[model samples]
Target: MLEPPDADRLYAALLARDPAFDGRAWVGVATTGIFCRLTCPARKPRPENCRWFADPRAAQQAGFRPCRRCDPLAGAADGTPDAAAGGQGLARRLMAMIRADPSRRWSEADLAGLGLDPSTVRRAFRRQFGQSFLQMARGERLRESLRTLSGDRDLIEAQLDAGFDSASGFRAAFARLFGHPPHLMRGPADLAADWIDTPLGGMIAIADDAALHLLEFTDRKALPEGLRRLSALCGGRIGLGRRAVTDQLETQLDAFFAGRQPRFSVPLRLHGTGFQRRVWQQLQTIPAGQTRSYAGLAAEIGQPSATRAVARANATNRLALVVPCHRVIGADGSLTGYAGGLWRKRRLIEAERAYAG
Candidate 1:
């Protein structure tokens, strides 16, 4: 059981019906349709109808439809608020600074200066963000390295431009993250790409002329599958090959960052289970920047009650950006759980919304 303060905050979200806490807390309705979020605005159900969980994932396990008005998943998660409240909550502050500056190389001393115990900073960041602060910073820096390397910039200059203080550190980080060194990025000069900084972290763009072909978050689980499929799709000898198409896609990505509506018309080479492919196909028709509910997606697939199955398929998608999995949200209009993390999902959608203009 959570402490009184924690429980109270969850309950208050229920009482005031704030959508901000939708995915963070769920409310069970003993009587009507199903469990909902504290932010559910469909008229308060009976006290007997009210039960709560720490997150929507739990509530969904209990089989609840998002209250239509509250649309819990849309405004689902609570950011690391404990850090925001406490005096210089070191963990939170360090995370915030890192999130804001992905290219900065933060030292232990720097983190200690931020009011965090150096060791604590190391462990907590891994626990919260799935990686050490330094690990994540390196990932971000490498993204810039990849973007520059695949473009017109010289390899050595790209390494320096990405803020690598030492050649050895830069080479090591590059090899570790991208499976190759900055100078060895030789296969394709034609493949276009750019580094996209999202709230969740950074992602790489791999596309050709006329359309955006690939967009994969370096850490996304779908990455392995994408690589495998790429080999198969390109006929087994999967090596980098530069093409004019790559440059076109890079320009398209640049347009996205600049808040311009994209003009991508390239065909995406997607791979997944039949069901997942079906779901992804549906996602493509969803427009460049609109959203759909998990339930709505299931219904569209002619499996009106198989919303969970649809969500499962979505989770397994190997082609991340090309398939546009981030376009899907919870039925109640709230953002739902995304394998890539909720924050990145939100940023992707928000960024795309601007792109739709």
Candidate 2:
């Protein structure tokens, strides 16, 4: 179990009954031997008697029972009426059915046949997942195809199994998402994309058995272009599914955010030009909470005149925090271009500084 840092901040959130920390943290009270959500209505405990945990399971493992006042086990306190809950409950049931057999095409008529109002179902799912039911089904189908492609199956076989009627149709859909056709894939042909939810936001991680190929925030503008370049380098074999490296990355990210781990041990598959590879290697050599200039990095690479080139390579880096591009500030110590945004860069640098101290 990972323990979050900044006890004072978490205690402040508890005192204010902040709902933002509900699912991300739990408070275990020593006097009552019970764990409650940060938004729990019960009286706040003394700072010395309060023990913060990352999740409810951690609290339970530490021998604390759930507080009867606030059912932390049942998600956040929405306070929705029973009628709304009942509709969402049906939507959940329908989602489960689709997940059970993602290869099967589900339609609005299908929901109506099950005694559900299609429009109501659509709204409920959209409100919860930020996507309509049909879009979710399409995503599931793509995931199924990716799972099949990870095996020894041929493209045609994988496409048909994913409920696509024609190879051309499947190729178009795959290209739209990954920026390449299924046939151009290289490497192990078992690449998978995993969505990871963090305190900052949602991130997408792509990996194969050997190493992590890509890790970027979902909202990054250059994400599609990066995917295309990675596919071209790997001979176009990217897919959607989790591998050993992805699982390890998820755990390491959790630890890193919790201030429990300072460095990542998950192997990376660095696909880039020879010069870019050298620059990234040098980036890894940078210590946490430190900054370097492009000229310094270029000099370190034995090409002091290649400062502009080094900055270009840094901008092209897709591995966000892992590659430490945020550490490479301007020569004047001004924060410069970062694909994940300068605000995020500032936050990362500050977090590292705090952790180091």
Candidate 3:
């Protein structure tokens, strides 16, 4: 567990019931052995009896039960509707409509027509997604265009199909974001990158029309270099966007983290040499809640003498949980060489073990 926060600041937040600190910190009362959110409505505890934790998990690990009144795990200040919920709901509804028909060009006038405040919708979407509604819609349109292009559709057709009114405008936007014009794309077309938020942290997912190329925690030191290598290997530019494969991967990850799913079915676009691909494929076969030594993986891949090579391939793997590289350990059974950090690797292995039972 991490060290607790400053006692004075946490106590101030607890006394004021600050909603801003809702998920950031939890206060545990030593006398009652209960943990509550910073915004808990219950009376604040005295300074001497209070302890601050970074998260609910930490509080739980410290032997504190959740307080019934606040239910800090739910990620809301109280059971009542939050001030941003209505606007957020409307933004989500609008997003759904936009995603359902990527060819549609939505505008502020459309929101007004729907009896919604345009500014409120914009603010809510920006707050939740960190982008304007129009930007997201454009990304969706670009994703659709890429999918169409993968199907051998012509550039003009793809542009119109993606809701763009002008060919030049489409070409410019595509080039600006992807670092290349759409017509210049060759081969199977590489992957688009998207961010996925998980309980552990934010992850970067890269995918194309047909398969997921990579999924790695954002904090991995080698991620940027790996992405560059993938772009060069696939002969396609990487841009900020999503594809059908990425969306599916996100859903599967959500289930896997929730312990409701044990395997991923999203197709993979393994971008590596035949030997490395074989190593990654073998890694997937090492079921959840199990660990394999580098030597074991080398043997499984029919290269028993290439344990070091197998370990190197595992270290280079960009797909983290889906590829199960974390399942590979040292010959002595110690966790080793996970780019996502040994702490995360340990937690992932632990979660899988508990779920597998």
Question: Can you write out model 1's per-residue Cα lDDT over 280-319, one digit (the tens) per residue?
Answer: 8887778766888898989998888888889888887654
Please identify model 1 stretches exceeding 4 Å from their true place.
1-105, 113-133, 144-185, 188-194, 197-200, 209-211, 221-225, 235-267, 272-275, 287-290, 303-309, 318-322, 332-334, 348-357
Give me the overall lDDT of model 2.
0.76
Candidate 1 lDDT score at position 196: 57
Tens-digit lDDT string for candidate 3 (90-207): 5567777887998887788977897666676665565445456777677677667766766666778889998899998898766654446677653443567766767555577888
Q: Ranking under lDDT, best-scoring first?
A: 2, 3, 1
Those runs of model 3 whose alpha carbons end farther than 4 Å from true positions after fitting are 1-190
Each prediction's TM-score versus the true structure? 0.52, 0.53, 0.51
2 versus 3: better TM-score goes to: 2
Over the stretch 119-223, how does candidate 2's per-residue lDDT look in tens digits? 766755654444578877876787677778756788888998998878888998777666777665534456777667564445678998888889987556687
Q: Would you list the clashing residue pairs of candidate 2?
A: 184-235, 185-235, 185-236, 185-237, 186-234, 186-235, 186-236
Best by lDDT: 2
RMSD, candidate 1, Å: 11.2
Residue 327, candidate 3: alpha-carbon lDDT: 92
**TM-score, model 2 to reference:** 0.53
